[model samples]
Target: MTSTAASRPGAEHNGFTGRYLLLLVALIWPAQLLSVTGLLAGNAQSQIAVHFHTTQIAWFVLVSSLIGAFLTPFVMRAADLFGKRRVMIVLTVLGVIGDLVSALAPNFAVLLLGRGVAGFYAPIAALVFAIARDVFPPRLVGPASGLIGGGVGLVALFGPFLSGWLLDGHGWRSAMWFLAAASAASLVLLMTVVPESPVRQERTPMDWAGGLLLGGGVSAIVYGVGRGSDWGWSSAGFLASVIGGAVAIIAFVVVEGRVAHPLYELSMLSRRRVWSVFLATALLAGTVLSAGTISQLLGLMPKIPAVSDGLGFSATKLAWIGAPASVVIILTAVATGWLARRVDSRYLLATAALFAAVGYGLTAHFHHTVPQLMTVGIVSAIGLGMIVALVPVMVIEVVSPAEQARANGLQNMLQGTLLTVVTQLFFVMMARDGRVVQGTQFYLDAGFTNAFRLAAGFAVAGLLAVALVPKLKRLEEAETGEAAR
Candidate 1:
């Protein structure tokens, strides 16, 4: 009788789509505001330069990511300590203040500080996924993960367009204010509608030393890569920063291997499946950042005077061209969750990566036409869409529910770190000539095509990683055993 009742189809067996929808609705604006910061920051680079003021946009991205990397693990643990609801509320409040500062800052330095402080909400990435895991049943974890992850795409859809409009009309200040309002709304909705996730009782010390070494290492590497173009790849400063960062990371691994209450368990990382998933994540992150770079370049690169192959697109048109990518991502993200249940996720991953690879390959080849760019945009977007939705689900499946929040933080941290590095690479390569390419003109340069080629290569590498994922089943089983302890 107990077994029969447990197996019965009811709320216990099914999932809460309504709850998921409510959370998604609540998150859309906050997530959008957070993400649009980069777009606005990047757009302001040229504007700042025009007024005889200059600062590398790469620095802003680096600082922003570093703030998140250092704070995420600690913040998630705080969610456990003080309660996820309480911590989320505090973080959202801080984010609003940061946004307001960015909007009103009179100088670039103040703006950078504001942006970094606002970035404290970076842990919100893990908090959202953790909530999804808590609310949904086992069967619906994938879709729930997808909905939470895809919420970013919802924000991306309008963020780029809105950012461009604001930049054109009211300057970057308007966009910053827009995000501030969005953040305020998210805080209210979360307070009024969302409840704390049920707690798991445990006594674990926060890993302070590990966080410092690992966070510092990642920040150094990201900073080096981002500044490499400005300082030159061979410069002493760049090389030292990169090497120093690498050493810090090596130390972190050694310390984590020995720590009783490690921020991230070294044993878990050694599991073949977890590492394979991490590898795919790094590549996918690189691809996503690279694609964004390509899109920005497309807008900046000029038309091929008499030829029709190259575009001389305005920032607004560029946003329109890129908007399809976000749209396709939304559709695929929603559908991929259902597909994961029936199909081997590894197989689906391989196939999706192939789509992205083909799209990027086509993009590299068809440097001339808008229609061709749009079609390829859809292709890669579909693959990227699958990635953002599925990667975290894979992590949850590979680990236990108790480890979900920390693991989610690690996955996000890894992706953010990779994205920071990739964006830095983009900036450095663009700055090599010491002259910024203006208005669709860089597409005519060889660097633009090379960047696309590099993005395709990462997608191809991801496909290869996906092919090897099933081989890690033993690792997954072993991880489950550990989590059980």
Candidate 2:
């Protein structure tokens, strides 16, 4: 697929019917909904803590992410070997099971296990991207990718409000049942409507060692970071986990370089554009996740006497305020897909970084009222929408069709890993020496303020990464000219 050939509109070779594409999008929607529901439900942290114990709430929220980060690479490879459809069915089944377990759990440990099972759904985005690239015509690729990427943000827009309403009216377990039913519906749709992709590679030896090392390493590091504040940062266990994780990662890299059929291609990281995007992705993931966690905390904070102290809004009201930003995310993502055809992607990324930086910076300083917070969210979401739309497309642009699934899978892994660490750090920042306010049942305003400032710094770092991405014109020209020949 040459750039010119891929970019040409209405070229019908290997194109999917509209219904096929719609079914694929439909199958993807539930996965997106499940992921966002967890984030939105973070607003109920206080309630969850009361039920499960304060020490376990963070684990409950992060367990799914941690499992997802480890499992993504293996799942992508499975799709490559067995089939995308088969893998998706397996994932959906696991999601349904997880949701049921979560809804019925009597203890925090059971809920944690259930959440881990739910992690199977997290990497569906990468598989969806691969399916789009394989089945859709080049012309439709951008739009398809946009929908896959933006779909999450779109659902996430309403996710908070929906979760809030359920929490307020039906309780948290009802939210679990809702997700379970959604997953089951998606499973039915996938089996009945979605077609198997024609793309397949010869079965190769699975990289079990690579998978274990990477997964274990990432889990260790995340656990260390998550528990550091509670265990004392300088404790032996914290130092051991962090160091062991670093060593394991180094070994994984070395082993990958030596393996014939490695789980992930380490060489891809050597490419300037590829590695730059990965870095930017890590920073973007960290910033976005941190900001979101902080926003939830802020929403849950009690209305204090001082205006600058807290908003004191109910979960439902907070959802309504933040809901508009989700709409903005969908709109901006669609626009981003359209814009990528005309504009340089590097320029698009740089602009996105700027929007994020400005949004976070302003929010850090001016979060005194609902309107102000909503405005900040909208601006940040615009940038987030662009990032969500463009990153996967750019990743596709850099790799061949056969490599798309793994590349996207690796991207998800990196994003999840960084997001986990960043979110844990934010929790640490918010919890450090903090007391629960009597009426608010949340942390002081100072913790949120500090966390937002740190989030802005991550955005600034992403800006620098985007700045380093070389101009895309030459690469585009080379791809087009290659096809012409």
The 0-to-1 C-alpha lDDT of every candidate, in the order given, reads: 0.68, 0.74
Model 1: what TM-score? Answer: 0.86
Worst 10 residues of 1 by lDDT: 1-10
**What is the C-alpha RMSD, rounded to one decimal, of candidate 1?**
5.0
* Predicted candidate 1 versus true structure: per-residue lDDT over 1-485, tens digit per residue: 00011221233435466664566566544544555666666555444433325545456556767788778767777676556667878989988998899888887788788888888877786777666565444555566676766665765577677766876677757877877887888899889766566544365788899888888887788778777766788999999999999999999999988988777766777777777777786678556644675566456444554321235565567678778888988888888777766666777678778988888887777755677777778888888788777776677666665666777777778888877777666555444423443321122445556667777887898888776675433212322211222
Q: What TM-score do all the candidates reach, one by one?
A: 0.86, 0.90
Q: Which one wins on lDDT?
A: 2
Best by TM-score: 2
Clashing pairs in 2: 303-312
Tens-digit lDDT track of model 2 for 1-485:
11112332233444446665666476557547555655655776656666664555777778888888778768988888887878988998998899899889898789889988988787886787777676555556666776777776766677777877877788778778887898888888778866665566677899998888888888889889888887889999999999998888898999898999888887888888777777776678557755787887677655555432456677788788888888998899889888877888888888888888888888887787888888888889988888888876777667666677788888777878888888887777766535644322345677777778778888888889877776553223322111321
Taking the candidates one at a time, how many backbone clashes does each contain? 10, 1
